[model samples]
Target: MSVKGVTPIENTLEINWQGDQKSIYHNIWLRDNCHCSECYYPITKQRLLNSATIDINIKPKSVNVKEGKVEIVWDTDHSSTYDVDWLRIHSYNPRLIPLDKKLKDDDDVLKQKLWQVKDIKDDLPQVDYNKIMQSSDETDNEEAIKEWLLQIHKFGFSLINNVPISPTDTEKLCEKLNYIRPTHYGGFWDFTADLSKNDTAYTNFDISNHTDGTYWSNSPGLQLFHLLYHDGKGGTTSLVDSFKCAEILKAKYPESYEIFCKIPVPAHSAGEPKVCIQPDIPQPIFKLDHQGKLIQVRWNQSDRSTMDYWENPEDVIKFYKAIKNWVEIITSPENELWYQMKPGQCLIFDNWRIFHSRSEFTGQRRLCGAYFERDDFISRLKLLTLGREAVLDSI
Candidate 1:
């Protein structure tokens, strides 16, 4: 029974959404999403009624539009009102055109200003710690904190100066935004030049440019490192915008780019000294969405294990060449950003987009840092900053 136009018949309610588009809503569905006091709690914004308890054949005695609201009076003597805008935003009509091409336009909503070292050399998106931090009793400074998060969300990295030079302070800072995502090493981990430690980060060695947690399926998103103590020399923290390097690779060598995007490189944490019992995960150096948009870049030459998934020698040869080409591009001086992190300075970077490393140093260089879940970071960003409307004006 196709609807001719917007009308409330015996059981169905058809809405004339746009010029020639009509969206149909059933009586039951309209009741389920009812914003009435009895149906939904106004304070908690939680639904009070159990969905299963609602009658499947429930009918509306009367339905009419008044002052931009759809008023519905059920046969059970319950009245409900729905704003037109709310219904429009949550409409699910297959024939109705979607707002955007992407299902979740969250990433696009950020309006991320991607860049290389040279792009941000003169004007790094740095903010003071006081802007983000809040007292126990006081509320957060909305605009300042929003700007701080906007910087990180846009640039894939940000610097926070005047952070407290204390253990777990980096982790505490993340609390202002979100919780710390725990890993095999532990949350709020501290690393220093220790001969007894198993990981290279614990030693004064020159670590090549790489993103952490390549072996895991759900890699950590945000990494915050606070240089609590760094009396050492030559231990300059190096960062490379892997996304920028990836674009370069995509343009120069499309074949290698294809291999890098398709081939699943094997990696495991068990191979690294004492970090054992971890599952082997296979992922491409470059991961793309279904629409062929670059989503993430996972690269760590040191952590990558010998992958025998593809027996074809030609495929294997091409995979190695792709990895080599990507590595060369990232390690190139033109892409590297060097910064000698001092005490009380915190570096926050995206683990999915930025490849980070440190140069070899002589003396002590203790740092406390923590990882934040990607989902939580994105969730916070949506609520605090302007949502889809932020990018709507650009359209």
Candidate 2:
């Protein structure tokens, strides 16, 4: 977007774009967004000026536009320049962006493509571990890693093949994400069915489909599972797309879905004697944003501590019915995806939208993996999916 001309009217700058489109920017908005060294710190890219201190009626004394840039000299003798692409991306003019497309400041920008059991059967996202490790730059010439991350973003999971079946290579692969999220079990875990931690994950029980870290306020976002060794029989892993299940429940059992969305479920982690973990604020099984878009799905009956949240006995009955329906939808044989993970296969999935479980097994088994902070993982995804400049434009 190149600026063709600018007109100041009633303390607002109206920019006439080269493509016959125009945008309106208030004087106060421009004055508050000065990009000078004193006004904005370049290294941090954070504003140094307090927006509240700027005068609301501030006007620019002069305006200049040249070479896809806009320059303005304000009445306070402050000068600022803006890249036209930034202005186009942040344009608030109704001509450019409709009311329905307007996004809240904190709303998630990534779009999702929900999947089913048969959707990815023949072409499940699988990336070569060697190709991902060959590239040092995560953002450039790394389509393999980007596609792997994109699959997780779109379908909630991706499998990385031939990971060398060792903690060292797994740790190196995770470090490419920048950091590992430490948990009650610790960071960069390597354990077998020795019950090192006091959790169901430490046993060879037939664990039902559930999301991990339901007991914490901010649960782990990305969970990596690498089957290093498992010679025993009858321990196949399964995953269910909880987002898809939620939609099915909403369509089939509207009442139960509403109850699950509105009601809160309490969960606690009391495995460790001195380390009890619980969420300060209880969350619903189906979490939605202000726009009613599903943002999270927290369903873990194993970790649920008590059902004492509601006072109405009828609500309790409805919740029970809801959970029953929810369980059926998630556990249905048609919806579940069973996999016999091989020794060199590594499965990384989104903990927020995917439910994982394992069937009971015999003999010894060893696995190694790590947890990733949601922000850190998404940061890499955004950068890899969209280049630095594109990310800035989207913001």
Candidate 3:
């Protein structure tokens, strides 16, 4: 294709193309898929797309393709002409392809996001353990605590040791952690003798590999737990990097990955005063992070019984089986890090990215749990550093 002249008249692009009449103008396509902040949200976070108001009807008026360059004119009076070379670089086909399928020019964005969790190393910000340890009893260390929490914000999780062992202390620790309990009970999973003893009030059985609070319309983003009494017996906490698990599944079972991407799993909780029913979250078991890195995995077999109801029952079965196997591979001792929480130690993790569970304990063991909205942490960090909250809510 050859372009004779290229010019931007006002906001419209003027382009001449010398190609078969059947060939759709390429510049027009580029204008429609512009990824610029003006065309789309600056932060292309998956959740942000729901809030975006895009003008999908807008189209380009004309296009011209020359030996080396192409020009595009927009139909809107205020639109701008774009160069063909630039258009080609940013164009993307909107067709929903399976996570395993590679689009024409896009790299596996999901894979790229997934691998980021594995590759994160020293580049992540760190908290000064000494400073936190030296804080006095009288001074308000909220500033210091905010600094420590910011490190956890940068890293998916962080650990603190030597907290005073008391229920009051546990509550205070959660407050310092900026805990924003879910409006519903979705955020807190109480591990108390009262709840555990009452089988009807709480399900005290062993929990399988899964993320928490999937039944909530808006699940808590961060989970915090403080060990009040370990008694030095059992109940070691185990955490698996869900992102790593996702990539392993994607590589080993491409068919299962495709099945999960296509199927919608139902998640709900019933027989309670506050019951929750979520019909289809439209989320991949694995998802890419803000930087286009895959770092989140949402899988809970107990809540996944709805998978069998999918239109493609066989595919759902295959996906369930694949995920079951994948969970086993990822949660194995070799792939996970297990830490026995001494009395008074606390653990906090990103709910969306990490899957945590504990081995059954024989004797009495107690732990206090709390959760904070994702934006709370972000706001705390921004306020600590910028002296004011960014006001940008919702991750």
lDDT of each: 0.77, 0.83, 0.56
**Model 3: per-residue Cα lDDT over 283-378, one tens digit each:** 566655555555456677666544445565567568768766786777776556666777666778878777777766666667777888877775
| Stretches of model 3 off by over 4 angstroms after superposition | 1-147, 150-155, 186-191, 196-204, 271-282, 288-295, 379-395
Better of 1 and 3 by lDDT: 1
For model 1, the superposed segments whose C-alpha errors exceed 4 Å read 1-15, 18-66, 70-82, 91-109, 135-140, 271-274, 277-281, 311-313, 387-395
| Alpha-carbon RMSD of each model | 5.2, 3.6, 9.5
User: Which lDDT value does model 1 have at 88?
Assistant: 56
For candidate 2, what is the TM-score?
A: 0.88
Better of 2 and 3 by TM-score: 2
lDDT of 3 at 227: 72
Q: Compared to the true structure, candidate 1 yields what TM-score? A: 0.78
Name the candidate, 2 or 3, with the larger lDDT value: 2
Worst 10 residues of 1 by lDDT: 386-395
Which numbered prediction scores highest in TM-score against the true structure?
2
Q: Flag clash pairs in model 2.
A: none
lDDT of candidate 2 over 165-196, digit per residue (tens): 78899889887655889887889999999888
Candidate 1 C-alpha lDDT tens digits along 148-224: 77888888889999888887666778787678887767877888777444668888889999998888888889898
